[model samples]
Target: MFNPKLHAWLERYFYQPGYFEIVISTLLLPFSLIYYCLVWVKFKLAKPVKFSIPIISVGNLILGGSGKTPLTKAIFNEFSNKYKIFIILRGYKRESKGMQIVALNGVIKCDVATSGDEAMEYAISLKNANVIVSNDRKIAIDKAISLGANLVILDDGFGKADIYKLNILLHPAKEPRLNFTIPSGVYRYPKSFYNLADITLKSSDIIKENSIIKPTDKMVLVSGIANPSRLSFIYDRCVGYEHFGDHHKFSKFECESILKKYNADSLLVTQKDYVKIKDFGLKLSILELKTTILPNLIDKIDMFIKSYQISDRIYSNSQKGDLC
Candidate 1:
């Protein structure tokens, strides 16, 4: 179902559009308008269900590569000591279906195939929190509550208008030249939707530190993530680069072949990609990128949690009185 060429074309069309891309985008304007209307209706008709537990949603307006996972990890690290935290996601490209518990109370319960790359990354990286992947977010939240989670962090949850929570929207360092939706461009939601978020953060708001251990002077960069161009910071140092579709499962043979093709001593990859191939017994150098939330953002999150704990009105789908 994943076409690498199509993916690459869309990326260029969305972010670095020239005259041809602009004309194509213009032709797709009607579809974008229709998509916008449908989303607007969905939000208007949404009856978001809220629970007694505090929920923090980190999401973005763009389609992908907005640093939601990193931000979620940062938030988990900040609050995991205080509350029984649960991180929930849709498990974008997992092989399994239904609600899957990737990790529970610091113990990993599933493998990469079952948990997907991002969820598995969370399970392996954050030990104190639970990680769950499910298409039905309401069911996932209920499961987390039953498992004694006092706080929940939803990854890429902005579109779930049916869930009432403190919304934090992330913006990429550089937005697309054309802000069209879906086929026309990469924006999942209109830029105006940013105003609805409880806190909207730019890429500059967070600090990133990149480090590589056992580094090679020139290595081949092999990555499977959205917006690979964002790695421009490390481009000058790499001898070669090979990009795959976001969350593409890499095989031992493929990795070895890539290394040979570039004639490089090692393959450089992101942390998210590392979890999948760690057991492959291949030569790898990880591009360890750590993200930290600013103090002001942390203070805002604390305030939201405090206010949520004391609030009496529980958001619900029904017009009846609030539950609990």
Candidate 2:
């Protein structure tokens, strides 16, 4: 199902467009237009269901990763002390079905295969929050509520207009040259849709602290994530690099063969990739990238939480017939 060459081609076609790329994008415009109309209709017909607990959604307009997981972790860190936080997402490319609890109160409950890489990442990173994965987000939210979650954070949840949430959209640092929807380009929605978000942020809004301790001079880099070129800083230092489709599960043989083929002493991988290969008993240097939300953005999030709490209290009182 996952073709590495096709993925690479799509990435280039979407982001770095030359003459041929532009012509291909032009040919695909009709399909993109149809995709756009479907999305518009979905939004218009959506009757978003409001939940009792406050929900914060971190999402992006692009097809691939836009640092949503790190942003979600940052938010969880900020509010975990005050509320019983639960992180919910549609476990992309997992083997399991129905709702699965990846972690509970910092303890991992399931393996990567059941939880997926992103959910497993949350499970391992956030010590105080619960992590759940399900195809149906509403079902996941209900499960979180039952587990006594005072607040919910939804990963990649912007598309779900059926659920009421404080929408936080991340704008990628590198905008696509073509800027068309699927089949033509990477954008799931147009740039104009940014106005609908409660709070919109850019890659610059978050701070990244890279931790590479005693790094090898010319190791081989093996990564399975969207936009591998985003790590060009590290890639620049590597002797060679092998990129797989996003969330590609690597076998021990594949890893060993890569290292042997490159004739490299050390291997480099991202934190997300590390979780999967950690049990293989292979020596690896992880690129631990710690991200934190800017102070102004934290303040904005606080304000939204306060407003939501106030409105929720008023609605509760009205339901109880306490206000006449």
Candidate 3:
């Protein structure tokens, strides 16, 4: 199978309807279709949880860069004070053996490593909010419930037929929309899966004003994300942008090489890149891009919480009785 990141590029290129990309997706489309069907069936069979608090899922039918984390934080910011909110992430790339609550001082920490970049980012971005990571989301959701979360949010969960309501789906606002699928394309679930979404969002729209900072001199655009283009678009205006893979664990040597090749004096990276680069203790100066989730979406999200308050009370009481 092609790397998911490479597949994202392939899908974008294939959407151009040229011979090379079309022939590639055509050859691979049969297998991609079979896999999609099998996964679709499995998704249907997966057990779902009925939560007391409304669970909003910010996810993508596609594999990467649907902007789940930014949406999660945006929704949380809207209602954190009005209701206790909890975020559950799948915690990709963590070394932890199994599902565990992210903790520091016996509570969740804002550390970007164990909690996944976006999870930690959101945890820290939202004051007094709970962030939990679990491969088994049911367990994670239960933990959040026990922690007195009145609303639970899942990041990067779309096709999973587990507990999700009020689905907020994000589509990347790049040049191509539906250009790819699995091995040859970036989509994880078929575009039909997007039908499950209650609201459709575009990550490109999240930033109203271009907040990209101008580079002082030569710089390299460092990223460890599925779609480096999103960051690249911002940096293209500033200086030359060099791209890398999603969740790339860059070594000290690699960083040095990138610096040397580009004559780059500084590094601009996504939040996900920050965690790995910090651990490496690289000498490059880093600037992070901030994503702003729009306010109207936040208002609608708040309304959703306010409507679910009574149901949350009953669910909390039921869980207490079961524990007793």
Candidate 4:
């Protein structure tokens, strides 16, 4: 339901300020205050849920396309072998309303319509983990634990004070890191709000510089994501783009139409967008670009996981005698 044009407009207001934008931003400033108040009320009223399992949250302040999806997938790849992981999605725009476990032990049992785009991507790619979709974080984790998930990775759960966990907030590589309320800007919270996170970083800190063509190459960058412009790294070229709305479903015709219009040498796509493409049967020679976390970041994350795991064990072991 998010309009791509409005998304572009917001990006300019938040990160790319000019004379006209400044005047517009000033007009929207009053609305931003109201937006901020609503956010505070929502979180304040939200019930905080706690789980014994370690939670690693990868989220963004600038809304979707902050590259959190790739980051979440990367972190899951790193820790899946050691932990029975569950990635929780809100199942945005799905017909269903409750939690559904789409994958378990590397087997996918649900389709994209039920699990939403991001959840389906995880269910499809990360065979070793479970993907559960639910708005209620507590219920999702409860189901996760019941299904043998020892760790829960929250998708888009930054400042979701409902659950006490390790939160990593993502900023785009080139974004000036604007923190305004929705309607006025992409950020739901203020700039100072990132301090609430365990780690505040750019996607560059963890993203792998995956192989791609130079900026001079004539490639067509095609995407249907919340933040299509965030793919700027791949756009370091004479790249023509075909962007769609957030969670936009691409038809087979649309896919072919784009390729025909651009007539570029190579095609580029996001992992999330690729799933939809496959479903639509638009199989072009596409370069799949995914960002990955850095090695040092892995170590830092591992340490946090270990610290939580160790304390959990100590508490579990200590409580044994008390139960007896």
The most accurate candidate by lDDT is: 1
- Residue 48 displacement in candidate 2 (angstroms): 0.9
User: Model 1: per-residue lDDT, tens digit, 50-161?
Assistant: 8778889999998778888889999999988889999999999899999999999889998999999999999988866599999999999999999999899999999999
Candidate 2, residue 22: lDDT: 89
Number of backbone clashes in candidate 1: 0
Across 1-324, the per-residue lDDT of candidate 3 in tens digits comes to 226566565655534546676677678878888888888887788787677668888887666676676667667776776777778888887666466666422365535556666565555446676778888888887788787877888887665587757788887665353444676566777777767677888754587433434344666777677666566456653355656656665777887777777777767665556656766655544554445677677777767777777667777899999999
Ranking by TM-score: 2, 1, 4, 3
lDDT of 2 by residue, 1-324 (tens): 457788677777988888888898899999999999999999889999999888999999988888898889989998899889999999998989999999998888989999998898888767765999999999999999999998999999999999999999998878888768887888898767898899999878889888864477768899999888788887777889988878989999999998899888777988888889988987787788788989999898888888888999998889889645
**Number of clashes in every candidate structure?**
0, 0, 4, 4
When 1 and 4 are scored with lDDT, the better candidate is: 1
Q: Candidate 4, residues 28-87: lDDT per residue as tens digits?
A: 889999989887787668675657888888887765567777788888888888888899
Q: Give all candidates' CA lDDT scores.
A: 0.88, 0.88, 0.67, 0.75
Better structure of 2 and 4 per lDDT: 2
What are the runs in model 3 whose C-alpha is more than 4 Å off? 1-14, 103-113, 123-126, 175-181, 203-205, 208-218, 236-240, 260-263, 279-287, 293-295, 312-324
Task: Give the distance in Å from residue 11's predicted Cα in candidate 1 to where it truly belongs.
Answer: 3.2
Instruction: Name every residue pair that clashes in candidate 1.
Output: none
Query: C-alpha displacement of 175 in model 3, angstroms?
Result: 6.3
List where candidate 4 sits over 4 angstroms from the true fold: 1-8, 41-47, 177-179, 212-220, 232-240, 260-267, 317-324
